[model samples]
Target chain A: DQQVKQNSPSLSVQEGRISILNCDYTNSMFDYFLWYKKYPAEGPTFLISISSIKDKNEDGRFTVFLNKSAKHLSLHIVPSQPGDSAVYFCAALGGSQGNLIFGKGTKLSVKP
Target chain B: DAGVTQSPTHLIKTRGQQVTLRCSPKSGHDTVSWYQQALGQGPQFIFQYYEEEERQRGNFPDRFSGHQFPNYSSELNVNALLLGDSALYLCASSYRTGNYGYTFGSGTRLTVV
Candidate 1:
């Protein structure tokens, strides 16, 4: 069974609009969460992360919100740009190695 | 500084054959981890190497194994490849203390026919 789930497979938004990607997890042991962005034929690059202790973490136009009680998280990109069109992965940080448990990922298409 | 580097950007192998992929960690990083990403799926952890030892592993079969050199470079070996084994193999480097998040390589695209 997958520990992390991104129900939406894709999201489309107009440039300069807001893009929201959501994720959920079944494992309570997950104490930290991260977001990664990937382009074609490239590895995932870390974007932002939030710890279980905080409900939110922000970086530039990207923000990650966590709800520990619901075991859910969301990534928000304000004033989304065309360059943001790519696959976004939601990951939970846990285990002895702190290896990430990733969702299937949601592809965002920001059109001009 | 150079980030994690993986070799053989792409590879092709026959079923039942074996393959080995290599990786060199980022500068000053001492730990290396591998993940497999199938088409349309998230990356799954394979295992991690620290201090030339296998520190942690995922639910992969024994056919999947790895080695970490003293210099923090690593190799992932898979025996008896299957069609399902074809995927983008990613190598990520990090510090043992977890202070630095991982830096990942573009990955090796392996195809089993």
Candidate 2:
């Protein structure tokens, strides 16, 4: 009964390469999507977000793409740096209370 | 300003004991939400407080309760702690009307033996 799902448990990429993390959601009422990056002993930090109205949103080295018809979204980071290594969580904003439903998370490792 | 502050960064308790965790919201934020994150799992919503009242709640049991002070700070209290209650508790703060996202605290780790 997980509303949001991250199929991949982890991902590895070389520095200067592109890293892609994927997520899926079962609820169609989700109109807003966000990505968060978390480091050890720290809280999740908001990365980027996209409204249902838009198919994509980009910020600096990070880009988020949403496909409403497929109920899927992906986060792309170009020129991945070692500092980018952390856990990534995909969250959806929906439900009656507009609370965020989060995916399990994908740990990203960038090797320099 | 400070983002969100959670107290007693870590705690250990025995079964049947009770525990209380505290949270201070970010500057100018009026809404407080608590979440529980178990091992290898994402954070799950426990409840949310706005204007000193419980505005929304998740599927947690009655053993989990909370309160919000007039200053927008919050406390999460759990009664009759069980071994399963061990997890990292997170507190998030945001504007009353804005639900787009939140600012989260580092979280308090609670261990029930």
Candidate 3:
């Protein structure tokens, strides 16, 4: 069974959109969550992360919200630009976690 | 400082052939991890090396093996490659103990026929 799941395979948004990507996880032991972005033929680059202690974390135009009771997390990118078009992956881990558990990813397309 | 560096940007091999991929970790990084990503799929952890030892592993088979040198550089080797082995191999570097920040390389594309 997949510990992390990104149900949406793709999402489209207009430039300057408030794009929101959602993720759900089955493992309750996950104490940390991170988002990574990847372009074609490239490795994933870290974007933002949130500890279980906090329900929300914001960084500039990006914000991440975690709902512990729902086992859901969402990444919001305000004023999305064309450069934001890429694959977004959700990763989760727990304390003493050896490796991260990653979802299938959601491909975001921001049009001009 | 250089992030992570992977060699042989792309390579092709046939079934039963073997392949070796190399990686140089970022400065001040002591741990190395390898991931495999198939098309339309997220990267999956293969294994990790720290202090020149295999510290953790994923659900991959024995065909996936790796080595971390004293300098913190690493190499991933695959023997008896199959067509299913074709994918993008990514190398990530992190600190041996502590924070979870990781730096990833561009990755090497391996195609097995």
What's the TM-score of each model vs. the native? 0.98, 0.98, 0.97
Runs in model 2 deviating more than 4 A are: none
- lDDT by residue for model 2 (A39-85), tens: 98888899999999999999999999999999999999998999999
User: Model 1: runs farther than 4 Å from truth?
Assistant: B97-100
Give model 2's TM-score for chain A to 2 decimal places: 0.97
Q: Tens digits of per-residue lDDT for model 1 on A4-110?
A: 99999999999999999999999998888999999998889999999899999999999999988898999999999999999999998868778888999999999
The order by descending DockQ is 1, 2, 3
* DockQ of model 3 vs. true complex: 0.66
RMSD of candidate 3 to true structure, Å: 1.1
Q: Where's the lowest-lDDT run of ten residues in candidate 2 chain B?
A: B92-101
What ranking emerges by lDDT with the best candidate at the front? 1, 2, 3
Chain B TM-score, one value per candidate, order as shown: 0.97, 0.97, 0.97
Please state the error at residue B108 of candidate 2 in Å. 0.1
What tens digits encode model 3's per-residue C-alpha lDDT throughout B59-79? 899988999999999999999
Candidate 1 chain B lDDT trough over 10 residues, lowest sum: B95-104
